[model samples]
Structures are given as C-alpha cells and as structure tokens.
Target: MTLRVRDLDPENPADLDGITAVLRAAVPPMLVTPELLWWQSARAPAAQCHRLLLAEDEEGRVIGRGSTGLAHESPEPGLAFCNVYVHPEHEGRGAGTALVSAAEEYLASIGARTAFSWVLDGERNLGFARRSGWSPSRSARFQRLDLTAPLRPLAPPPPGVELRPATAFADDPRPLFLLDAEATADEPSDVGTELDDYEEWLATSWGHPLLDRDLTTVALVDGVPAAFSIAHTDGADRYSSGMTGTARAHRGRGLAKLAKHDSLSRARAAGLTEAYTSNDTENAPMLAINEWFGYVPAVTEVRHAKPLG
Candidate 1:
C-alpha cells in the first residue's frame, strides 16, 4: 500500500510507457504517443528545465504522473507550472499531493516566484487545490468536434488570399512563426507568452512531434502568411488545433476562420475522426468560431496560482 514519487528517467522505455498508460487511462481524448511524450518532456530546451515525474505503489506500478517546467517563453520572469494527474482508481492516495509538493519545491529551487497548475473543474480537484493554498485564476474550456460528421463547406478566400497547407512553408517556416508570435501575443491567457527566440521556437514548437504540417492550413495574402491553423495529430483518428489565429492586420478578413475551416476539412479527409481544441473562457471570438464549427464543450479546467517566496 506504500506509494512514492520519483523523477521519471526520460531514457527509460518503461517509464515512458508507464506515463503514457496513465495519460490514456485518465485523459482518453488527448493522445499521448511515445514520440510526443519525448518531444515534450525530454527534447524541451535546457532553458525550460522540464521535468516529468511518476508516482508508483509498492508493486512499482505507475498510478500517477506530474509535469513541471518554467514558462520559458514568458517575458515576465519567475513564472512556472506544475500539473499533476492520478489514475481514477488511485485518487484517494497521497500521490497527487506528493507530486505537487515536489513540483513546487523544484520550481522554487529553480528561482520560481509563482507557480501555476490546472485543476479539472470539479469539487474534488478544486478542494485539493484549495487545501494546497492555491487559488483559481482563470478557466479554459476544452471543446471537441465529431470530425466524422459533415462539416459545412468553407467559403472561398478573397481574391488576393489563398489557402494552403502549412507544409508549403516547410523550406522556411519563419513566416508562419511570425504570424504565430503575433497571434499568440493577442490570445487570452493568465500566463502571457511571447515567442522572441526563433531558435527556441523552432526547436520546441515548429519541431514538435505531434504537429501535422500537411493537415495544418494557412491563409496566404499575396503569398505572405496572414493567418494559420496549426494542427497536431496523434497518427490515429484524433486531431487537435494547436492554434488557429490571424495577424492583427488581417483580423477582419476572416482569414483565421478560413485557415481553421480548411484545416478541419483536410483533417477529416486525412481520416482523423475527432477534433479537439481549448480556449480561454474569456476568448469570445475564438469560442464563437469553435461553436460555428460544431465543437461542443467537453471539459473545463481552472488555472490555479500560488505565490512562492
């Protein structure tokens, strides 16, 4: 009946599979392939100092997992995050608390002055966060669309605009990066981020394992990327909208919607049966866009923050 939390060795296949199993059991909709896990927890740049931890019982079976890392892209310093998840069958154990404690200690040791975590919107999860001295800050909604159903046809782009797959920019993704950076700065979030380092963005985001370039759609205004819909696929039937945004200059042109529509159509054609995306509760425009695309509310999670001296 004993339980212990330990840092997961990224080089160990057993640990990777164990975490993957935990994720599958807890969050079935979000796909977590080995490649995606490695890209996130292992290949993260040294600046982020990402750490993945697992909680195991006396039998050495993984029943919970935690992820901790700095918000490296935030222009504001001293911000970090730690999210903990336990198997439903093992919720009453101390694994979640131990993992969160370890995460806060590690972050504090690394110079973090404030830590953030996402707790599923529920009485138990909220109660746990409250007991740990964390307060809810912002909430986000996860939405999913049945890609197997017929999607409304996308309207044609303006005469000067053309819709293209993100793969078209493979030889040079910097343009898309610029668009992403601009759009990201405008997106609603408690933890604001700016993509200032091109190399870092290239290493972490552009090179992410789940990113599906061929299915990602972009709107080109006279051959310049004006809006884009970044897609992440699990190599199966699941697809996620990593981001769907338009540059400020192109906001009123419906370029963002065009990009997302095209991306969703391509994803369905690619045999992806499910589409998932998350939006800050206050992001009304994005929320309306998702609703138009037939995405239904799946779950909500509140961002909890705790200040650490």
Candidate 2:
C-alpha cells in the first residue's frame, strides 16, 4: 500500500478528526481534541515553525500523525522535536517512518541541527528509534487518577496562604506567567526551556482552548501568586494537568501540592472523571505529590535524539 505524507489543514474538519482519532488510539492517556489540534497548529509562535504532518494511505485514510517544531524557547538553538503517532492497527505499515522522515526534512530545512522525539517505552518503538539513529536521553511517565475515588482530605492552607482558582487572576495573568516561568525553568529535562516571551506565552498558553481557568488552582501568599496547577479539560470527562509549579521562594512550603490538590478537587467537582499527568523520572518531588494524590503509573516514554546535517 502506497502512503503519502502532507501538512495538516487545520481548517479541514476531516483532517482534524483523522489526526485526533489516530492520536487517541495511539496514546490513550493523552487528552486531545480537534479544537486543541487546530489551536496548536494555528497559534504556535512563528519562531517555532510548528507543523502537524499527516500520513495517509492510498485509501486516503490518516493512519499516522506527527507534530514537528523548533524548540524556539530553549536557550540553546538548533533544537527541533518531532513526535509521531500511528494507530495501533497500522503501526507496521511504514507510516511512522514516513512521518518521521518528512518531519526531519522540514526541520532541517528550517535550520535545525538536531531532532528529538519521544518513543513509547517498548521494544518495537525503541527499535524503530534506534534503527533511525536516535539515542535515548531521558524518560517520563504518564499517570492517571480516578477522580471519582475518594480524595484525601486537603489540610487548611498555612497561615497567610490562600487557595484560589486561577480565574481570580483573569484581570491580569502576568503574575501567573512569572511564577510559571520560574517554576518551569527548574523542571528536569534533556532540553532546557526558557519561557521568556510573555507575548508568546499569552498566545500559546493563556489563550489556549483547553485551559480551564476555573478549574486551575493557584496558591497565593499574601496576595502574591506563589504556586499554581494549570488545568486542561476536553469539555468532557477527561482532565489533564498542564503544569504544576512553585516559585523559588515557595519551595518546600507545600504550595505546589496545595495548588494541585485544589485543582484536582475542582476538576472532579466539575464532572471530570479521569485525571492525567506526566512527570520526568528525575522529578521526584512532583512524582511523590502525584502518588499521594492516588495517581498510578500508566505508561512511560523515552526521549531520543539524533543529529542532522
């Protein structure tokens, strides 16, 4: 069966549905939707040069999809990423390879010197990356919690600390952005990211379609945003923690836990039944917090990288 690769058309409903279906089948813990896919491809910063690639068989069915882009926010330049996902039933049909090749060519064309990808931790997936000349770097685990289960009672916020919905800062989100920037800089990862562009963050994060401000919880200390747990919902039963972080000064104060617990409770109250989150294997603090929240390990994916000419 001959296959062809092409850029995704966000305006095309069929394209949106096809890619979303493939992603959902390939990675069940992930929360994706047609609207989220559209927003990612359309609102990405220009410097990132983001492209959503689709692999179609001769029958015109989208069997695989790839998200490729530059690590524009990294302090280091010439870094690019391409994460490809193929429907389980279609995995051995060369769709994943075709999508990756097409993605690399595009990244190289845009001045990228190295490409990175996340491969599910399985012999088949790892073998594919190895054959493609990529080497393992680090791994992260996806976890899930049954929000319908009984949650441990949250303790009262320490004196001078308050738990509030992120919506409270709707009038001005710059404070949240600042805290996010600080916390994200400390996240353990192979590719370091610097969230310095406030405007870009506003466009890609603050204005994102899935950001549920009402469900997101923030910990405030003396009226200052100290830590936060950002929430993303599919407008259905699925909920994901986009990010949870605490400011440097707030470290060891349990603010991150406070924020995430409140956020998860709010999500459950809002009718979200499943909650999902991911943390790098080296991030013991966040992992411990999630475990305390009753999140169990779901799957792990290893980050792999290859240099390009």
Candidate 3:
C-alpha cells in the first residue's frame, strides 16, 4: 500500500513504457510515445531543470506521472510548470499528491517564483486545483475535424506564394525555424517564449520524433517561408496540428489559412482520417481558420496559475 514518486529514467524500458502508458490512460486524446518522451528528455535545456517524474504503486506499477520544467527560454522569467495526471483507475491514492509535491519542491529549489499548469476545465478537475490554491486563468479549446469530410477546396496560392513541404527544407530548416520563432513569440500563452537558440530549435522542434515533415506545409512567399502548419502524425489514423502560424508581415493575406489547408489536405492524402488542433479562446484568427477547415470544438482545457512564495 505504499505510494512514492521517483524520477523517470527514459533509458529504462519499463520506466519509459510505463510513463507513456500512464499518460495515454489518463489523457487518451493527446499523442505521446516513448520515443518522443525520451527525445524531449534528451534535448531539454539544462537551465530549465526539466524533469519527468513517475508515481509508482507498491507492486512497482507506475500509475501516475508529472512533468515539470523551468521556462528558461521564455522572455518572462521565474515561471516553472507542472501538470500531474493519474490513471483514472488508480485515483484516490496518494500518488497524485506525492507527484505534485515533488514537482513544486523541484521548481522552488530552482528559484521558480510562479507555477502554471493546465487543469481540465471541469467541476472535478477544477475542484482539485481550487482546493490546492490554484486560480483559474485563460482557457483554450481543442478542436477536431474529419479529414474524410468534404473540405472547402483551398484556392490556389496567391500571386507570389506557393505551397511547400517541410521535408523540402531538410537540407536547411533554418528558415522554417525563424518563421516558427517569430510566430510563436506572439501566440497566446501564460508563458512568453522567444526562440533564440538555433541548435535547441533544431533538436526540439525540427527533429522531434512525432513531427511529420512531409505532412507539414509551409507557404513560401517569393522563396521565403511566410507561414507554416506544423503537423504531427501517429503513423496510424490520427494527425494533429502542432502549430500553424504566419509571420507578422504575412497577416491578413490568408497565408496561415493557406498553409494549414495545404497541410490538412496532405494529411488526408496520406490516409489519416482524424485531425485535431487547439486554440486559445481569444485567438480569433486561428479559431476562424480552424472553423473554415471544418474543425469543431471537441474539448476545452483551462489554464490555471498559482504563485508560490
């Protein structure tokens, strides 16, 4: 009847699989894999104090997991984060509490002044954060579309723009990386991140295990990447938009829409049927683009923040 939290070892077959299993059991809709998990752990920034911890039962079965990391790259400092989840079947035990406590202690030790976590916006989930002193913040909605559904045909690219696959830039992904940095700096988030490290960007974003280069579409304006839709596929029937964004200068020209539409079409052509994306409720431009693509709101996740002394 003992419950304890311990650091996760990505190299350990049992630990890695068990962690991914717990995540899948707790949040089935999100895509996670042992390989992707390990890759992230390997390439994470050292200053971030990023750690993935596992909660194990008496029999050595990992039933819960949590991820905590410092926002090292964010322009706003002192922000750390943790999101703990337990298998529904294993709830009511002390695993959740143990993991959360461990996470808070780790972040505090690293001088994190504030912590942010996403707790599903529901009575039960919100109740947990509230009881723990966390307050509600902004909310986001998850949307899904059936790739098999009839989609509004995307009009041909504008005069000087053309659709290009991310794979085409395998020899040189720096352009896409730059575009990603510019777009992400503006995305709605509790944390403000500005990507500045090229190597880190290559390791974390361009070389991610789940990112499907061929399925990712970029809109090139006169040979420069102006907008892009990053895609991740499960190699099965599902695909998701990791991010879709356009540079500031490219706004109002339907470039983000064009890139995403092109990526969705490519995903469907690749035999993926279900596609999903998430958007902050206030991001009208992205929300509108998703709607145009037939993506309907499937779930909503609320962001919860708590300041620690």
Judge candidate 2 against the unseen true structure and give its global Cα lDDT, from 0 to 1. 0.93
User: What is candidate 1's lDDT per residue for 23-57, written digit by digit as tens?
Assistant: 87777666688777766777888988999889999
Score every model by TM-score. Answer: 0.97, 0.99, 0.96
Encode model 3's per-residue lDDT on 47-139: one tens digit a residue: 778899999999999999899998888888899898998887898787877888899888888889899987766787788889888888999
Give the best candidate by lDDT.
Answer: 2
* Residue pairs whose backbone atoms clash in candidate 2: none
Shift of residue 105 alpha carbon in model 1, Å: 0.8
lDDT of each: 0.89, 0.93, 0.88
Please give me the total number of clashing residue pairs in predicted model 3: 0
| Candidate that beats the other on lDDT, 1 or 2, i.e. the better one | 2
Model 2: what TM-score? Answer: 0.99
C-alpha RMSD in Å of predicted model 2 compared with the true structure? 0.7
Query: Best by TM-score, which number?
Result: 2
Cα deviation at 266, candidate 3, in Å, is 1.1
Which window of 10 residues has the lowest lDDT sum in candidate 2?
263-272
